[model samples]
Target: MSATTRPSWTWTIEPPDGWLVVPSTATEPADAVRAWESEVVEALLESFLPEGATGPDAPDPDADHVATVRGSLTQTVGSLVTFADEAATEGARAMAGVGLLDRGPVPVLVTVGMGDPDESDDVFMTVLGAKGGNPVSPPSIEYPDLPDGDGIKVSRVDIDEATGGAWVSVAAGRRTEFPDGVVDTALVWRSQDLVLVPTILDAIVDLLPAVKIIRSTV
Candidate 1:
């Protein structure tokens, strides 16, 4: 698509207290990877080595431990980079961030992306198909306060694996028409805490209003 016709939108959200939002421009894949890695490493270090744990001066983690943490995160870094790249290619803005759920410090991946107006349905369905499992209707999420369009459709899918047992994936998508064009937004996140689905969904609802469409000057 030409620059003037490209779909553009901005997403802003105030993550819950424990949650962290790793900002991303989606224009550079490498930058996204580095930002995510940096945020995660810091969060991990804080959780593992709480402030003032060792007397008045908290000891810093050794180089070896830091290296090990980065090494372990390498496996997932590529996926995040790919996600950011794809969003950029599709003329969409996206953020690939990590969330700290109630279940310990197990990092949860949260992605918010805005895509071409014409591909709104496809974007929503693609997220729902991420786990290839039956979609469970998410808690009633209505955005009556927002503009009119295909209201958001949210699905909760339970993914089971031989090694990982089971985890819950939530995907929500909405297509809203702006003065320029129809812009779609998708929010997806995975967590092992099934009981927190409602809370997560509520968060998603709170995030939708923050989406602002960028009108192309050309």
Candidate 2:
């Protein structure tokens, strides 16, 4: 399909202050991703640097800590990109957006997609099933009130031993059938601070209603 006539989806949420949202759609430009990475790197340094550190006393770009942070961020971004590509290969139209938390330098990822109902259900079930044998708690399901459609949300958290962190994953789908397929969305938050995960999940849930499916045509 030509760029002008291809249909695309987008979210319409107004993110809270201190949050930066970067578009990761299939059509998003490479330069935009690089710019986002730069912004995130700066935010992370500012958050981790000593309170009074500045100017000549700042950490060197070649320092181990700086490199570690950059490497981690690169891996996170790369994983999300690969995921979106895989979703497309499954006959789904998918796009992802990255949310950067300035103070904690935390990363939040949200993905929206549309595909056959059976295929989408199978994919969601696979994710839920993978959590079965782990020590993490079981996934929770809830019906959310949405403006335009009936909504169902499933959420779970997985503990990461290597980093002593946790990843909270939420998959919310609205029963809105389009000419092409059904609409679904997923949100993921990664953090080492267990105390903050609940607050972040609450914010994610509040924003779920703002997700809208948009179809574009020239």
Candidate 3:
């Protein structure tokens, strides 16, 4: 596809990479970035696979939405990691299909499940990138446009978002050094994206306050 010829599908170009992903974009607010990523993943899943082939067998979806629509959903949530692993598995399969894993673009897999408190600063999240299914070796580094004190801990996970699958990149700077004592939750920020399950949707609806926009019928 040529840049001059805009495809029917939405296309965004990355700085030096081949494609620019929405979740990987730098402008989104940190608070809701992960949620936004989940939303896009769900939509992609819906776009692919047969109606009944999604749900439990598909990528993890938001819990809040699940409860309300579960009864009517064609798919089910087999387990918590269903969504996370599914996304990775799909990405690998895609790379393989195109014969690219070894020589093609590297695959990035992220778990939106739960951020590991051990490595991150908060309970909210910490984004992680796995290349070819393993934690990205030598973690990536992303620098600030202007000289800043410290840069984000990782680099972007570059992957083409395929149906039902998400593309994640590693970034540098989410990690901060602790001299020797326990640190407070205040230390952590959204940059360290943890794996978020579809269950998070329920958390959002129940207590997690967020500005929600409803769709309108034109």
Candidate 4:
């Protein structure tokens, strides 16, 4: 396996540009992927908890539930076991990093989890959709740009009514041919606050049609 594997990326939106893309290279691909999973879960829990509700000094059951959910999401993503060669590893490296795109007070947390097809299948579900007997309700939002398949899924969760903050996540799958077989790719986005849900949704819808993935041997 290549020691420093990284994938190239192309964005769909420009005016809404300036997303600071970060590659997960702090450690090996597998370790990096795990680290990202932990961070994403933390961000999610932060979004769900009431404002000023958490502190290292206090214990909260709600916070515990959020933590459990994070673990679940990580396990779900990690369960992808049959992805294309090195794709998971390489893509995970591409998934790391943060970009702050401010649209007035609403904050958008953009996450990338593309891994090499030759590696592991962990991040595959995020884009290519998941394979199993599990079923989820259809999304309230329509993503016309997303291709239909088990690899792509979208949903919205209303977290807090008092503050009106909601969470929206998009798992888009892409396919690229490799010498071994066809490989899949995926990306995820989570909104920080209530006022930003619609904005994030719109941005994702507009950006989906423009995302491009390519496999290289050079």
- For residues 110-178, could you state the per-residue lDDT of candidate 3 as single tens digits? 222212335644332243221234332444433333131222333333333355344334322222223
* Candidate 3 local Cα displacement, residue 45, angstroms: 16
* TM-score list, all predictions: 0.55, 0.54, 0.20, 0.36
Q: For candidate 4, lDDT tens digit of each residue in 1-218?
A: 47686444433222235332232333337576567556655654455456655567445766776567566645533432212122335434222212324331122223243345577664454332243222344444333444522234454443455775654454444454444554444455544444554545455444443444444543
Candidate 1 segments exceeding 4 Å error: 1-36, 54-56, 59-100, 103-144, 147-150, 158-167
Error in Å for residue 39 of model 1: 5.5
Backbone N/Cα/C clashes per model: 0, 0, 37, 29
* C-alpha RMSD for every candidate: 6.3, 6.8, 19.6, 12.7
Alpha-carbon local distance difference test for all models: 0.52, 0.56, 0.29, 0.42
* Top candidate when judged by lDDT against the true structure: 2
Candidate 3 lDDT score at position 130? 15
lDDT of 2 by residue, 118-173 (tens): 66366644443323535387777777787766666666777777885676665555
Model number with the top TM-score: 1
